[model samples]
Target: MQHSVMEEGTAYEPPTYDETFPVLPESASSSSGRLNIFSINNNLQLGRITITQMFRVPGEERKFDHSDKFGERESIRTCKTIMKETNTIIEIATSKDQSLTFLITGKQNQVLEAKRRILTTFQTQASKQISIPKDHHRWILGKQGQRLKDLEKTTATKINVPSVQDQSDTITITGTKEGIEKAEHEIRVISDEQI
Candidate 1:
C-alpha cells in the first residue's frame, strides 16, 4: 500500500531577470539620427546593456545588388556580409529553416537602423503568418535558456520560448519595433543559411 501525498504551497519564489538587475529609462521620441543616443547611453549605463529586438517584415523583399556573389561566400563570409549590410551586431549558428533565431542588442535607434538596413539588404517583406518550425526552436532557446538570458541582459527585451512539449511555433519577442526587426531578420537569415 502507498501513502497519499499532500501538496504544499511553494515558498520558493522563482528567480527573475527584473529582480536581478536595474532597468534603463525609455528613450525620448525627439532624438535625431538613425540611432537613438539617449537610449544607447541608457543601455550603456546599465552595465553594458544592449537591447534585444525583433522585426517581422515581408520575407521576399530586398535591394538588388548584382555585384556581390552571396551564394559563393563561406559561412563566416556570409555572416560577416549580413552583419556588414545591417550595421548591427550579429551571431550565426546552424539550425533548420524554422529553428533559426537571430539575437541582437544595441540602442533603440541603432537597433531600428540595423533592422531597416538588414531588411533592405535581404529584400524581404513582412508576412502575416510566420510559420516557424518545431525543431529549430531549441537554437533560439539555447541550453537551459542561458543564450536567451544573455540576450535579455544586453538588449533588455523579454524573449519567451515555448517548451518542447508546448507544440507552439511562435517565439514571442517583446521589445521596441527596432529591436523586433533586428531580431527577426537575424532569425530569418540564420534559417536561410541552414537551408
Candidate 2:
C-alpha cells in the first residue's frame, strides 16, 4: 500500500467522501449524534427554579416572649424538615410587620410541594379586639378564671382581658379567623347577659 505524509507546517484537510452526504454542524457532528439528547438532559438536570411568597399573620409586631420563641422554634424545625423531605431550599425572612417571606428553590414539583407543606403547617392567625364594660370583666373571668380558660380551650384561642388596675374595656382574642369570630360572639353574649 502507498503511504502519504503531510508536511508539519502545512494545514491538514479532511478528505470528503460523496457529495450526497451533508455536513453537520459542530454540535451534531459527534459519532453518536447525541448532542441534542445531551443538551436536553442538561436542561432537565440544571433547570432550577425559585419562588418567593409573603404570608401575613394578623396582629401587631410585638416582642417575642418565651412561648413565642418556642412556637418560632417549632416553625423553623418544620421548615427544615420540609426542605429535606422535598429536596428544596427554603429561605425565610420576617418583615417589620411580622409577615413571613419564603423563598423556595428547587425543581418545579419540589418547590411547589415545599410551599404547600409550609403554608399548611403555618396557618395565618389573626388577633381581634372587642370592648366590654370593665364591670363585665369579672363575668368573663368567672370564678378563678375557669370560665376564661374554658372559653380559650373551646374556641382554640387566647383571650386577654384587661386587668382590674388597667381600667381598659378592651379584650384581645387571637386565633384563626373562625376561632376569633366564635370567641368574639361568645364574649359578647356573656357581656350582654349581664345587662
Give me the candidate number with maximum TM-score. Answer: 2
Candidate 2 residue 94 Cα shift, in angstroms, is: 25
What TM-score does structure 2 among the candidates reach? 0.41
- Per-residue alpha-carbon lDDT of candidate 2 for residues 58-140, written as tens digits (9 for 90 to 100): 33432343344423656778788998998888887776565566777777657656655654456456789998999999999
lDDT of 1 by residue, 94-135 (tens): 233322234555755556555544443444333222446767
What TM-score number comes out for model 1? 0.32
Q: What is the lDDT of residue 190 in candidate 2?
A: 98
What are the Cα lDDT values of the candidates? Answer: 0.51, 0.72
Q: Estimate each model's TM-score.
A: 0.32, 0.41
- In model 1, the runs with Cα more than 4 Å from the true position are 1-130
Question: How far is 30's C-alpha from truth in model 2 (Å)?
Answer: 92
Best candidate, lDDT: 2
Give me the overall lDDT of model 2: 0.72
* Model 2 pairs in collision: none
- 10 residues in a row with least lDDT, candidate 1: 92-101
